[model samples]
Target: MPAQNPTGLPFDDIRHLVATMPAADQAAGDMARARQGDLLKPPGALGRLEEIAIHLATWQGKGMPSADRPMVAVFAATHGIADRGVSPYPGAVTKQMVGAFTDGKAAVNQICSAFDAGLRVFDLALDLPTPDITQDAALDERACAATIAFGMQAIAGGADVLALGEMGIGNTTIAAALCHALYGGEAEDWVGAGTGSTGEVLDRKIAAVKEAIAFHGAALSDPLEALRRVGGREVAAIAGAILAARHERVPVILDGYVVTAAAAVLHAMDASALDHCLAGHVSAEKAHGRLLEKLKLKPVLDLGMRLGEGSGAAVALGVVKAAVACHRGMGTFSEAGVSDKA
Candidate 1:
């Protein structure tokens, strides 16, 4: 493939970027592991917290990981499939919710405040929705690649960790369609009644995903093509953000089905592409757990959270904080004058 897409965005650049991403620091992870055993606690006493600290240390390339500058980035876009009534909320709600995030009125806002994480909400051409997937590709190759480039800038301001969340009404349908195309199952396997769609609306949602797969055909075999066809702008942006995070050695916390769809595209290309990401939660939205299985990622929480907007990711940030505090703040058995088993 050429290094550039039709719009002059470098598709080859994306491919090379994912392929050449930095590997985790094995030395740092080993050091962190040694410290975990030295901490004044019984073996495995801290469970996932111990593991979480090692994951951060490995990716951050430090013996002690820092959750001090955790940041939550929310990408908001409008999906053309939303016009099909796949979600109960109107398409305009995508923009409205972005406003709510900036105004500190959204559920994620309270969670971010609680966690003391910086919050940044990005609006990706909400006024110009992507083409409806059932009838046409969601975006042209150039537009898709450009949106991805824009997403790569998400972490430019820098944070030690990145938690991704998205808001795009009817995006659950887009997410389902992307999954069906990428993973190949019954459309119903990936479909979910997002925002309370059920009965007739749910049927329409499934049907739309089926139509999109049929329409895209062989093109879906290529992850980038699948992304440009059925995926939304936020999906493209999220993929870019994930790549950017990997290149910069920032661990990612992914929220909900839509955000995972973005990661799926990268994972399809390189299985290790999402190695830095942690599934923040198993969403109440159906098929989410199934998708996580496909990614081989164990989520950090399972609170039945179906609300999008980085809410789940924000909640998991608190867990990450606990892990960091335990890993870095505690004294080793020797330093604390505690005895270790011989």
Candidate 2:
């Protein structure tokens, strides 16, 4: 295809970013919460979410965590596993729906606008035109390099927080295949209804995932190869982007099942990959919970959102923003003129 924007940053650049910046130490959060407890409020009146916000603030290395310019990056591409008839919607929907998103007609568009979050779309390997479309799949060296480069550009272009969502009809098939390869289990474990399908369709989808895993077994021993084999262009791209975000010190907000699956694969490759990730929600998918457990992340929401277009992440945007606000907005007991006595 045509040349997209300059490929992602070099591997060394990514490495440098990671080395220079790391997640804030948990000790700091513990200390901050201890201070909060001694404050005038009844112990834990602000609740668990407030503690979560404080923890995130400490991670961000700021008294207040403000994702003032949060940006949403949606990767759209086709999945080879879809050829086995995994999704109810035609694979063509991947390309078409991308158009809807770009034109600002999709539900994601509305949410992004409502929250003032910048929206950036990528075509890792789709047939249509997007703001950025790279030539490599997640498994290819060029693609991985390009994904890192594009992600860096997104970060530099003013995205403080990054949200990842995918838009390929049969991406769940690719997700199931990747999960099986990385976590070493059955595709049926992670496979579930993607883009709204019937029970029979879901079964066919699961079988396709299994078949793809078997067909690509040898290549999948390598993390990148598994991505190349049955993974969708967007899924791999998201993984690369998440890694880049970590290097750049930008927090990554993860969406539902598909994005979680990608995050799991990234974490499997590099345990530190989870450092900057904020789990958006626990999707309704059966394996989503398992994936979260594997990553040791507690989601911010569980609104029963099953939409694949980053809807879960978008919904969680308010809380993340609020957390940042709380860190900065809330007054210390001294500032509020309250006694610090037990």
Candidate 3:
């Protein structure tokens, strides 16, 4: 893994960038719609496939969209909350899985290889975990913003589309707290059996989330504050990567539950900030579908997957490529010498 470029920005700068995100290229989207109609298929016959093509066109600012350089950027980090018996696995598993990714043995690696997509793994100071959200702020304002700046580096490999995923033991607890803070739901609505927690372990996870939110209190009123207070390093980085993709006109595919928490932070800042992203899948994580619905993103797949390493997003990338291939490779009715019904 190449060293991440050094970047240290403040929250104000991140907020400003989010506030002024570029709108999608509507002209290109219109042209893509027209092109779809010209293809040898009935209008809307392809369903979400047609919509996906237009989505890429609009975000990529090109009528003929390309997924030739799809990339998956997976961020891995440790959470101090793991000390609270929130996750069945210890926090050390975060580092171990990151090694598997580097050795090309992880599920996401296989998925990216299957789709012919490039893969990048970011280890965000796995040795130095964020503070336990139930005990203290996960990160101060400066550290949170800096982590985001580092996350923006995921865009440097010239990928046209980015799929965001994360690995952090106990992060489900972190995400639950984030969602409860952002959406004002009871902690149970946001908590789930992450890492297969159940019985007493699940109860601790729920209590941890409720305690963290109550402790954070008025600080969570601002979205960024909410992120820094309860979010982990990988969460902040994913948020940065999504924002960078939007600025670069690169469409994004968001992976399951943990990844969506990052997007929720930005969406809280600006409702349209995630206009360039698509939900890669709805995971088996119980709250993932609820989170996706709140974000207004219809997923590309729903295979009961809960392994988080951007694997689902990588699989969804294949679907996106299929949509692009069908839209651009199929012959128009005129070229195919097909007759039209009056």
Candidate 4:
């Protein structure tokens, strides 16, 4: 994983790449809605499904589109802040749970299996052995390079869309801190109970996030520096994936608060980075709402979920697929000779 943007494409190029794809998906959705109108339904009888069709049309770059091959890329890394007790669980759980995900013993695995999605697990920090199950594994000399490169490779590996999830107990602290610095919020405001901590431990968690935010404020002036400051290997990796997804022209599905934090950093670095994103779901964490508002994103679901295992995004995959189907399949007004509101 050499550090090479050999083309030296400006961030503008990346921004353009990321920014322009939604139009295609949008056109697709519009076409779908037009067709649905022809299907003998009232102009807006299908309700939200019409919007879904339009969204699908846009996402697929066609008038009719389907989310046939959605993909999930979950990155796992250890964090230094876990040493400060920011999380109720130990940092060891990051590697162990990632191992479990790779071993197909986690919720993400079952969800992906159920959805028939292509799943990727990356050891961006090389903290654990590459289990037999990871579809793609990269361990290189430079963690940052490898992590970013892994993102490129994931897109090249035929992921229609990308979902970013992370494992690391204290990661919420780092992510919250990054969110504060990137989005100009207080760390206490963004920090939440990761892994379901309560009482005194939660208080400590909030304090730890505030501390990290204060310490990292200077470095956070630059997006990459902010990523380096409080970001775990997995988060940094997701940042790369976000940029790469933009470059590769794919829709990115974001999970909970932390992933939104990564998207926030990416957005601050390049505002157009958000153009390709479809927010998966709202998290129970309060920080998520603020971050989502900052990003101006509306989540597709609200399952009262606090889990950060990409499960929410996985569920959104189904919705996206259904949207695609509606766009591609439903009939239009003219075809059915239904209405005259043109």
Q: In order, what is each prediction's RMSD in angstroms?
A: 2.1, 5.2, 3.2, 5.7
The per-model lDDT (C-alpha) reads: 0.91, 0.70, 0.92, 0.69
Give the backbone clash total of model 2: 2
lDDT winner, 3 or 4: 3
lDDT of 4 at 231: 64
Arranged by TM-score with the best first, the candidates are 1, 3, 2, 4
lDDT of 1 by residue, 94-158 (tens): 88889999899999999999989999999898899988998899888878888888998778877
Kindly list the per-residue Cα lDDT of model 2 for residues 1-342, writing each as its tens digit. Answer: 112334353444434443454666666567666656555566677675576566565655554456789888888877555555667777788888889998999988998988889888877667632211112233455554455455445455756688888888777766777788888777778887777756888888777666666666576786666655556557656776776676555677899888888777667666776877889998887778888998999898998878878878987887888766655566778778887655
Q: List, residue by residue over 1-342, the lDDT tens digit for candidate 3.
A: 222334444777887788668899999999999999989988889999999999999999999999999989999999899999998888899999999999999899889989999998999999998888988999998899889989999989698889999998999899999999999989999999988999999999999999999899988989999999999999999999998898889999999999999999999999999999999999999999999989898999999999989989999999999999998899998898898556
Which residue pairs clash within candidate 3?
none
Off by over 4 Å in 3: 1-9
Candidate 4 has a TM-score of 0.84
State which candidate has the highest lDDT. Answer: 3
Could you tell me which 10 consecutive residues in candidate 3 have the lowest summed lDDT? 1-10
Weakest 10 consecutive residues of candidate 2 by summed lDDT: 129-138
